[model samples]
Target chain A: MIPHDEGNGTSKPHAPRIGVVFGHPSRQYAPGEELVVRYDVEGVELPAIRAMERTVVWYTEGKGEEDLGVHRFERIDDLAGLAEALPHGTITACLPASPLSYEGVIVKIRWCVRIRLFFVAGRDFVSEHVFEIGAIAPARGVVERVQ
Target chain B: MRLPPFFGKKRGHRRTGSQAWGSFGEAVFYAALVAAGLCFAGLLLTGAVGIGPESAAPGWMRGWLWIFIWLIPGALLAFGVAGVARTVRDWGKSEERRAAAEGLGTLLESMGQSPAAQHPFPGVPACDDLVNSPGTILRYRLPIESPESWTLVGMGLFAGLWNAVLVVLAVSAGIDIASGRIEWVLLAVLVPFVLIGVTGIVIFIRRLVLTTAVGTTQLEICDHPLLPESSYDVLLAQSGSGMLRSLVLTLEIEEMASFRQGTDTRTERVIVWRDIVKEWTNLEITPGVRFETHVTVAIPAGAMHSFGSGHNAVRWRLVVRGQPERWPGFVRVFPVVVHPAPPAESAAVRHGATADGVPG
Candidate 1:
């Protein structure tokens, strides 16, 4: 998902609100495991949504420019599809083996499921839910040692 | 109760218009500079400005002054053109990105289809180039991180340019001396240029000799994109004339992080883990023949996979440190990637085991 500061516009009061919940309560997953997500939209009518995008992506966060990869993506624009996905929906995808979640001193990798609601006004609202992808230990601070 | 739009506090979530305004302002500033440069050049060309040989200055002085005076408008024109070109390029890129975003939205909405799959390893570097070059014994040859030939060429170029400048100054001084007029200032300038030129030449020659004597180190691996908990054979080839000291090969994991501090960006790298793969002491390499050795590299089961992003990386490399007799030591690095281990079930299947943990 694009960061708010980098995106083009802001969410308005009447904008649709998205709520996402993962299948696992712990929100931690192993590599090559299936990830299931359920989402619900509220505070706006289905007609206001020009399109809806669901994506499972991992992004880098820290001192560097953000890099991201989409593992799964789906778009629903038809009225019938929107009707089914508006109030409630579910998405499932088998995660890839690489780029496990990492928490480092200066670099961190995070996985999230974003449900973006694109309104007719050319603005998008992205709701992200963070999850873990691996059990790798977090990297510690720099330690000076002579070679 | 909902607050009115006018009185509502603007949350940081909204994208700011400052970037657009900044780009527009930059374009305008560069456009103005271009206009000013053109106007100045036109005035000079039309003889509106009184900078010409018509003045009482000497002929040679006037010629030099004319060139010096034109440099102002030349620099302005160059900077203006470059800035304008950069602005146009940036504008085109932004437009392309905007169009792509809009097009993807429209296309997906109309077709109701998913986009293409992303790269398997998002942040990892591609190993296509590394695997493309076939090795003699091993399957793949790992390219060096930084080749010594490039450094030799750079040093040679610097020495050549510096000596060229020194020769020009010496020729001018020689002409003055032959004409029975010793230009003290020219001679004074030539002295420093001569010293610097000689120093540069000496440095370049020393580096060339060292590079030749230390020779080249090549590493070849049995496979590409290694996996954890696996062992692979590696070939180390060392070629040089005289190497009497020691040669060490080590497998190291390094973490690099870059952060911008004010105007400058500083990068820091640390070797988080290292293990000595092999070491050879008191080895002599004959001329025109390479010393070859085979070693096994075993990756730790819990090793972190190679990772790379915009400004941060976790890299694995095989470093060859050679200490030569009568020459400074040199280090050559061969980068390698370690991928995450396959899933347990898949690994079991590869080992010819069924899902019930029985041999199939």
Candidate 2:
């Protein structure tokens, strides 16, 4: 797992540290292909983790209201289950065919895996890792020709 | 999934005391409206109000007054119900979040199922409705985005309603004149209304004539859910009795983006690319026959497939523009969908050839 920092400068010393590793090194996938993700948590105990959620979703960004679609989701609250998954976990899902990752002039679609940890004190921390879904080339802005 | 917050402290970060107090105050206000509505309804239904037949008013007028009075409770009840529903929905969302935080829901693993399978391409429009109608020569007929008949009907309705008001005003003025009492204000108003009514009629007539002369434009395609780098046959049919100066068919791709600006939401669309597919000049059509022709349309090899989301879209359309000999020019649009290209291996297999263009 590659460690990732939350980057919240004010976070306490005991705040959780999370890392995620994609199955593929390049983090790129084709349509109908399986995407594998593994994540690890550090500096946080299992008992203090009231709940945890893992999700894979695609969302739109840019000059429009954001739209999202969930591809996979799981929640765990059992302390024993949390302990088993605390240090490390693996998730696999088959990506959808459409809505391939697009980099357009005004709109873009992206895929990401989110890991959220809810502590006993009612505070939650989320970590996100982005990956590409398809090999479509980026779009170019059109130049208008006056006739 | 999340559970209701009926039993625990609210989830998420703690808020300031004042913010909590403000929310409590708002809830109380809505609750008070509901209580007031229920109390008023009970009083009205139980005949607690003093309205009766003994009131000093005619029976017909009293009936209207009772209806007007009942409106008070009706409006209150409507507002109260709407407010209650909104509150419940909001609370349910909060509870859902709490439940999620508590990990009380079942696992929702959409492993093999795609977003398209569950929601039919969440943001993209379903093409079944567009492809429902059959065509004469092509496999499917595309419906125009906007029909001109609706515009003609709107114009007619506006002209009819405006003239009706003008007639009522003219009769009122005539009655005043016959009584030897002239209301110059009413006469002056009549002058503008008469001019406006005449202008409305003239405009409506011109639109009607233009619509009848330009007729309908029908586009038919050989296949749908088009693939990139593929060519398909399209049929164009125009029906009307006139000399069309020029008819041009063009393929266009447009980008649409919507954003919220303060209190208002604005949507902007720009035609990013356009290519003229075919053009005809000096076409004559009889009333009984239509002008029909077939053309081949090819999607560029590296074109972007059609995409749609809640607030953004890349759309493809075929537009037909025609300028009649005497009437105004008209344009009709037909929307189409372009799906992503198939994998190279699948394409090669289907085409009975190797990837390098050698016979298999």
Candidate 3:
């Protein structure tokens, strides 16, 4: 049973609202700090990967901070990609709305997000992380993977 | 009872030669302090050579400046020494017991009787695709006998210092961030990050301090995202030294990827671990990586899983399966803070409990 989308509708602020200091793919949040946003005020522990699965879909209202919105954080790995994947961490998806700060998830989410091991080469050959874009794609930002 | 003049008199300690080695903790403290002293002296030597603290200070001087630098190694060496001593001591007793048991069995056999000892460290259910990555240096489960102070101190000194070193580097980087003058020498900040390794060494110490009271060994396995079901061997042994009484049993447990499991929920005992006697520790296992491992006690006919003072608290012997031979075991003990049960009302109170979060 897929869980419902958890976005705005409640009075309390969600956890911490995240913002970008001008759009830059390589830079946004600190290396270890998390990017958080919510529909309500209470701080909620963000759910994560389940069993190292390839992908997960979060349902959100896709609205700016001013308006009530819903969004999703698909295969978003790390803060930079997390912020870049969604221009403003927005996912345009609709589902039967339910409870909590997090919208309902369909499959149990993968607990650990695997990031590309950049710089040190001789790994998976691909210089870009285009493959991950589909999972973390904004309404736009979709790119092709070149070998 | 007139004895030789030396009989019960306070005697000189047993040392083959000179200088008795200091206890593990003291030795570690000395080693760290000595190393730091040398580093400081090296800096001063450069100062003597007309070099000032500004640019005159060499790279080694900066290494000694991290937080809790000496305390880390000192604590770790103490902890590690404690663990090794305990292991060695237990190792001796196990050998002795086996020898005595064998001797007894032989004597009884001559008299036409069977006085056999149970097989040492019975086998456990074999796991499928057990993984020990290159990243994992060593892994083991707690035996009936846990390692002592030096062991933990050694582990702590190493692990804590290692982690502390990293924290120091990160902090220093954060400090250096303001000026934005990080001289990255071709992917090398040239910063001596050996301290980071030092911090990791003291990780065990931090763990010891964190978990001493909460529980006797740390819940190590089954926490990693892609966790494997593992078991360690507890070698049931007898001491080789005949004079000592009280049997010393050493059970080793190692980690394995996956073990034998029932096809479905129809069977209650899903996972099983066979001991040296071939007796199995069966688990009512579940499907995923998380909840497949658990500690379940047989509830009395009318008992429910409850906890209050002593009336409701459930205390059961938890036997986690491990491949003891696969890796060396460590008993990392530390002081821990125990918390009262969460209020019944707030759902958010519990984070990582059970397969849902943490095991109660």
C-alpha TM-scores of all predictions:
0.70, 0.75, 0.17
Q: CA lDDT of B233 in candidate 2? A: 80
Question: On residues B60-86, what C-alpha lDDT tens digit does candidate 2 reach at each position?
Answer: 898888899888877877887787676
What is the C-alpha local distance difference test score of each model? 0.74, 0.73, 0.26
Worst 10 residues of 2 chain A by lDDT: A1-10
Can you tell me which runs of candidate 3 are displaced by over 4 Å?
A: A1-147, B1-144, B147-156, B185-278, B281-360
- What share of the reference contacts is kept in model 3? 0.00
Candidate 3 lDDT for residue B52: 41
Candidate 3, DockQ to 2 decimals?
Answer: 0.01
Q: What TM-score does each prediction get for chain A alone?
A: 0.88, 0.86, 0.17
**Candidate 3, residue B6: how far the Cα is off, in Å:** 35
Interface RMSD of each: 4.9, 6.7, 30.3
Indicate the DockQ of the complex predicted as candidate 1: 0.28
Please provide, for model 1 over B1-360, each residue's C-alpha lDDT reduced to its tens digit, 9 standing for 90 to 100: 222232333343333443345566788888888888888889889999846656988888887887887887888888888998877767623222333354466456646534443335545666666787889998888998765668889989999999998888888889889999999988888888888899999989998888877778899988878766666789999998775599999987777777777899877777766778899999999998999999877776656788886677888889998888878888888999877766672323222111221110
- Stretches of candidate 2 exceeding 4 Å from the true structure: A1-15, A142-147, B1-122, B147-151, B178-183, B241-245, B281-289, B301-304, B341-360
User: Of the candidates shown, which would achieve the greatest lDDT relative to the real structure?
Assistant: 1
Model 2, position B268, has a per-residue lDDT of 66
Off by over 4 Å in 1: A1-18, A30-33, A41-53, A72-87, A116-125, A134-147, B1-120, B147-149, B241-245, B257-267, B282-290, B344-360
